[model samples]
Target: MAKGIRFHYLHRDSGNYKKFGHRDFSNPNNLTVEEITQRIRQALIDTEFFYPEKVGIPKFLFHRYGDDFSWYEFESVEEIQTHYLHESIEGFIAKLLRDG
Candidate 1:
């Protein structure tokens, strides 16, 4: 069986990073990386879970293992698009699901 990938929303303050929440696909097999990315982008824009006046835009991070993970701090949609083009969803997910 294949492992699933998960993403966590984080907030950084004075060099400290804390997890606020996470988005995990209930049926990961049916969801593609593009879909997940789009969902995350929408979440960022909605800002319903964040207080911009108090905390600013939050950072996004993904991990499926204790040590294997990637962090992204995007300022605009263009940057996210660029990252998607350069990073393969399969590869990223594979890394995420890898065990230490």
Candidate 2:
């Protein structure tokens, strides 16, 4: 499991990515697939309203980089939730380890 995950939002004011929040899960690899999905859902709740600079398209994502600096971009909460149902934990982990 990852040591931590960072949540970023494309800021409306500066038009750049800004760190909003993060979590350091304790033994995330031990978590069941459902537990992982639920945790992500709860974290994303109402985050669209976080640190708004102007009314525009929501550009929020959560990502975690491995020691090699490879990361996977989860474009939205809905996309994350949907993928979890169809993808295996091993496959997801592989993507996290492989993608940037």
Q: Write the per-residue lDDT of candidate 2 for residues 10-87, one digit (tens) a residue.
A: 332232334442322233354554555554334332423322212122334432322221122233321122211333
Candidate 1 regions exceeding 4 Å error are 14-24, 46-100
TM-score of every candidate relative to the true structure: 0.32, 0.24
RMSD of model 2, in Å?
13.9
Per-model C-alpha lDDT, please? 0.37, 0.32
* Candidate 1 per-residue C-alpha lDDT over 12-38 given as tens digits, one digit per residue, 9 for 90 to 100: 443354445443323324456466556
Which TM-score value belongs to model 2? 0.24
Which residue pairs clash in candidate 1?
Answer: none
